[model samples]
Target: MVAPASAPRDLDRYQAGLAQLRSHYEVRTAWTSGQERGYLAAPDSARTAALHEAIRDADIRAIICVRGGYGCLRLLPHLDWTLARTHPTLLVGYSDVTALHLAFYARAEWTGLSGPVVTEWGDIDAETTEPFRALAEGETPTLGSNALSPLCSGTATGPLLGGNLSVLTRLVGTPYAPDWEGALLVLEDVAEAPYRIDRMFAHLQHAGVLDAVSGVILGTFRPGEPPTDRPTLSLDTVISDYFEDRPYPVATGLPYGHLLPRCSLPIGVPAALNVEEDTSHLQVLQSIVAE
Candidate 1:
């Protein structure tokens, strides 16, 4: 979990949750600078590399960021994707970690998750626990709620990919941006206005990011606002307008993003998308790690 450079008020809770999480699987914690001023500042490269090595050598089945903040992108250029590819594992995080998720998908063609972090442990609600447990236990064909918007009705199958929209947008021209072709693109964001969302989508469309995808899955847009005066456009409208007459399926609200009881989706694994009934289902076709 990306602890702000400052000590957290709930450090004990965080530690306790970490302990519980470790009961199910091996857990390790690493950080750039414990006493640093900002969470986004670049991590010490030597130390960061060492931590990556430790994780790689350990043959860890999963890697979860302790938290999300600004500096994860700083480690992107230095990351050895070769090691990650050889030692395939479930790399998981959200928020700022979105940058890393994009890097993994683009560089390694490996599936990762844009789900809860260490901090989310203490806040775990019943709604989230089942899916989280299922993911950890390698359950397949997970089905989720249909509360999200439905732009079109259809089913498409491809690898799952995406995370925080803002972070995804940040890597637009970079080598880390995902190859959207034949991929089920899922996205979510927090604290942005509808206009900002529209602009980001516009950017993706202009960059040819959206056109290549097999389908689109939109997660929660938390803390976002529609303009008060004008009847601002909804997310569904933006999606439909963007993918007008596109062949791919478009479905929203897969219970991901900054929401309780989120699905621990594998980013690079082939999965089926069924939107005809306004439901999205993901089935892990094979193990993400070598035995």
Candidate 2:
């Protein structure tokens, strides 16, 4: 497993999940960091090389990142994508891995998994793991936002794009920034306070990013709550402002992101969003695999 970010706090926790993943697949881990504690995977080093090689391996159909703390952003510039484009693979992970997802989308138009990583695989249930398995098995996987309640009611269709709100916002104006036009942006994150969420949303709105999207799918916003302080703006209020007077469909409670049993989602694929009649649904319109 590549340490594309902060090394796992406890090696054993990650090892347990690695065992679980191997149980399901012919896993070949790239221990690029030599089982080191805390990362020193500098650019163009073994750490970055391992992931690039995996993406380009003709026989390795998928690449699952082991953990996501904070680091993939630094590895983006150093990546070599020729082999990856020639030999496509499913790259999976969320949080800090958002950098890699959008980078791949912009550089190669390669759709990848914006889902749970290895260490996060503890207590994997059908509700969570099934979507990812169906995706890997190429069964025209579609994840439902059954947990989501409508925030703004409407129906829309566009390419599904976005992950970890903070990571995505960081890419704004960068070469790797995702094209927001006609995209159904799905966003989620963990630990950030509601105001910080508000700030990121504001950045997008001001940058004309929000206006460029057809709709928004709100995934599990970590704590899924507003601050306890009375003066604090509820996450609902902060988000609602972005959609106010706009017709974009907005909804929440998607079982993705930092939530348990997180469902897998494909980046840069066409998907339909329905948020009418008090219900919210997302139907991925195509298999993400390239023909």
Best by TM-score: 2
Which residue pairs come into collision in candidate 2?
A: none
lDDT of 1 at 178: 76
Q: Write the per-residue lDDT of candidate 1 for residues 117-154, one digit (tens) a residue.
A: 77678778767766666655665645554464556677
Task: Identify the runs in model 2 with alpha carbons over 4 angstroms from their true place.
Answer: 32-44, 223-230
lDDT against the true structure, each candidate: 0.69, 0.79
User: What is the per-residue lDDT of model 2 for residues 143-191, given as tens digits with 9 covering 90 to 100?
Assistant: 6646767778888888899999999999998988878898999998888
Reference-based lDDT, residue 81, model 1: 83
* Count of backbone collisions within predicted model 1: 9
